[model samples]
Target: MKLREWVEAGDDARLLVIIEAQDVLSVELLRRQLRDMGEVSCSEQQAGTWQLGLLAHSCGSLDVCLARVQGKVAALNRGRAAAPAELVETRLVSAAAASLACAPMIIGPFTLVSQDELECGPRQIRFDGGKAFGSGSHPSTRLAVTLLERTAAELVPARVLDIGCGSGVLSLISARLGARHTVGVDICPDSLAVARRNVERNNLSSRITIT
Candidate 1:
């Protein structure tokens, strides 16, 4: 299903299911299992909780979708699930944009800009706020970016490796900061896809590799 369509569905749209778990592993597993049923996105929440959001089409009823998701969550967590899947409000895109806007994080020379904002200057990274993580909003990602910037001069003309790369932000930034080549590795195929798109968005395909 097209996520844009779901986001724009308005009042006629079926409610989207948001499943919460305490750990990233459960979130990842739920994402893998429920992806085929709809569009799934996972993110880390406060208090060590992780959320898996599934945006399903209005073609089916909300109850049916919730039941299916609950069953999947049960299978993954074996009755230890943190919480049941709930129906979230509409305007999914707006909600996502707001979440990103809540924290305008600056990482080194790059500043993460929201969709509504324009890139007023150079060294700005724009994220569409897609399913993959790493919009530079998280503390860990910001820290990594800061560390990379501090050592960017030393990393010039060198090959850099990024493990668990999300949204390929680090790899892209590394390439921008003078790394001759960057290799981003992630276990999630969905994350790799998002990273590849981000790499292409910044027009650094040749300098960065996402796998």
Candidate 2:
């Protein structure tokens, strides 16, 4: 069934809509259209493609918003050269589903422990795993952590700046790896909020800054 039809058929109060866009322009277009209805998070899935996660409160509102967005995108595609935007997946979830989805696991040089895991062993990191993207589960986040480890090994006391630093995992890792300081920057307010929380949870607030 189509995405709108699927949403229209459901009674879920909260919905997660995952979208894929070939370029930043397309991603921004979708964000602009849906910004008023919900919170939008953007993360790069590959070199040129990006995945957008949008959390909306009501399925009825989403059904209507999506219809309007589809029409706008169609009109834009016909009049401009920007890439097309499309929804890839949708799911029904509770408010804390994102945090509940995160489980303790090892990622590169550090251990990612959920916030509930009180006793953090050596190299264990605690995070709330709120609505932010990085929970150390994604392959991209893992690779980034690994590369940071290798790079930090050669340069102790180095400062780091992480752009689009969802959940501030990389910044936290850099601080743990003996970086003098780290700054994390992200466009999504939800991501920045969670990243700040994680920074505090790990007691790395002195070494890391999120904005």
Candidate 3:
């Protein structure tokens, strides 16, 4: 929906970056580069594939950015022992299509749902990004949540302090798991805003503090 709004507001199109690779280090680097480019969201297509959605203001600019990224990926692959298949693929898709492709992600006992999927149960985490990062799709996010669940289970009534909390997923999770108080701090204003909205959406504003 945000992508649709961007296109409607005069952006050229939304470019979908499809990547199939088993290398975690390479994917993390590429994700960082894409994030630097502009608005980007990552979703795992399957076991070893990742879909990165980016808003393109101009086709020419998109092409140049892709070329630069491909060059960097190629350089990184040169050092690897075995290269993955079809490391990079591109497609221009409408916002509706992108939305469907980037569907809800189930992380541990929690499910990350968007605005459209509001009929979720108590374990659902509703997160709509306003140019903020972390949607419970990345491997790191999933792992972090898994670890949090393990630790939080043992530590009852714990207080959580999340530094650089993007989207406030961890803080929300801590509160949901019965933490006494949760504090999420972030340098990015967009992240703080999104985190606060998430806290309110989950009705954990009393227990979770976003700043």
Candidate 4:
């Protein structure tokens, strides 16, 4: 959700920089420029022939913010624009960041946990934010982590199994829970690479094996 989400559960000072276009990459660049203005979170979905979205930010004023966003959109339209339908139009909204709902998450020591906004046990978990699939988010991985934590004493299976392991992080979690033997497998080489990095970062070489 970041700072780019607005009009849901956020504050009243933020603005939305909405861009619509047929070119996805061009729209993405516009989104990046919006970030330069302030904190931004965006969502995109294909609506018939056009791409629809909402870019969230906290620009100072409506006019000034619109000017900034429009100028950036013009810059993005220069050379890389493709097809006649790919141009984008921008709009500004003075919405608050509190209006949008963002799943609150925290990572610490070596784990990531998500909780309700009202519940604030830990503040932030600084991670490398790598390409790994598990940055301590996702339901299935969280479920598996809970399983690992609860059954640490009863489970005797040396080799663990994680189906649909993104970034091979489930194995890293299993190893963290004291699994003596661990191996992670995945179809995505990038995800595997991410899993491997997580394992090495934790220094669980003797316990965790990732591929």
Candidate 5:
């Protein structure tokens, strides 16, 4: 069983801790221990998995959140250090953890994500199971979109490239924002799949090309 929990100390602060175990009792022990930090909740999931979520507080700004989490993780290292796992194997680091918090961004009539929506945005972009890649939830992408909205005419770059396009959410957003023409490329095929579905979901296949 694997248990994961997150706590936000501020608008953009995010802290996540996870415990992995083979037996239920061990998992329960860790869950109980972590619970003392803040509000605790657990939901039994399929395949004998239990998800534990936590909300905690510590003094700091959003800028310090990542550094603080890194410090905490470093403090926990105690000595030995293994290569960081790609996925959240037993820890989450530099992961697009926007779900750790969410901020509302007003797009047209409805609000797009403004703060940490990745932490709150649907796990799957429009429910494309295997799709994985860049999250529009990042502040960087959100801010870029805002800039694009205002200075697009003056800063009209002939071609736009997303170095690490994830689920194609941001790329599609560009198309939806009127880029004349756009193409989204991702190193991960799953992300490409997700982007394609997202395009179709928004019916933007005609505007944005996904590769």
Candidate 6:
């Protein structure tokens, strides 16, 4: 699940630690070490580089965990003298929804509506912003939705696959637009968790699946 969800669901305080790794190997090593202390989540930032996020319920154990990570990093950078990894505490901010253009987006016959916005018609898509990316505000996602709108007629009763489906927005939209089945796939477990919630929120769980 998203860190924000976990933080809000539990009564205990949660800590989020973010770190930048020099390479994929470093990220893997850091994840393995941190997993012993708490839940570890990693995402690739660029070629050969990655970002690691560690979440824990106990604040008292954070100091010891940080110290152990520092010791490990120091040992790894002993002789070669590469730049040490950067680590910091981070806060989770809730994402807000907004219209893509000047007005509510009109994709084919369906209108995309933000959670805060009132339902416009029967063909409305209710989407809310979440910790996972792709809230339907990004230009790339808008473009994809537009393409799907234009070609929706040709895709009736089709089965769709959405790769790297962050929030499962496209998959939900595809199903609403008449696709018989939609499957959303992502490498991040947190993303899939959010996507599953989103699918259920839209009442399209019968046609959408997140993996």
**Considering every candidate listed, which one attains the maximal lDDT?**
2
Measured on C-alpha atoms, candidate 5 has an lDDT of 0.45
What TM-score goes with each of the models? Answer: 0.54, 0.52, 0.66, 0.42, 0.40, 0.47
Per-residue alpha-carbon lDDT of candidate 1 for residues 1-211, written as tens digits (9 for 90 to 100): 3566655754456446666676655655666676567555555567666566666644465556667877786677666646544333333333443333233435567665543454435777654435666655455776787888789888897999999987787887888889999999999888898888777777788888888
- The segments of candidate 3 whose C-alpha lies over 4 angstroms from its true place after superposition are 1-13, 36-62, 65-69, 75-78, 82-89, 115-120, 128-141, 151-156, 187-191
How high is the lDDT of residue 13 in model 4? 49
lDDT of 1: 0.66
Kindly list the per-residue Cα lDDT of model 3 for residues 135-196, writing each as its tens digit: 66666877888888888766466788888888888888788777889899999998998899
Q: How many clashes would you count in candidate 2? A: 0
* Candidate 2: worst-modelled 10 consecutive residues by lDDT: 96-105
> Which portions of model 1 miss their true places by more than 4 Å?
1-14, 79-153, 161-170, 176-178, 183-195, 209-211
Error in Å for residue 59 of model 2? 17
66-155 per-residue lDDT for model 4 (tens digits): 666666766766675364323244433344333342222332223332111233223222222234455443445556767777787654
| Native-referenced Cα lDDT, model 4 | 0.50
Q: How good is model 3 by TM-score? A: 0.66
Worst 10 residues of 5 by lDDT: 85-94
lDDT of 3: 0.67
> Candidate 1 has what TM-score?
0.54
Model 3 weakest lDDT span, ten residues long:
51-60
Of 3 and 4, the candidate ranking higher by lDDT = 3
For model 5, residues 90-187, the per-residue Cα lDDT tens digits are: 23222345343322223322233322223333322232212263333234655676866775564344345655666665665565555766778877
Worst 10 contiguous positions by lDDT, candidate 6: 93-102
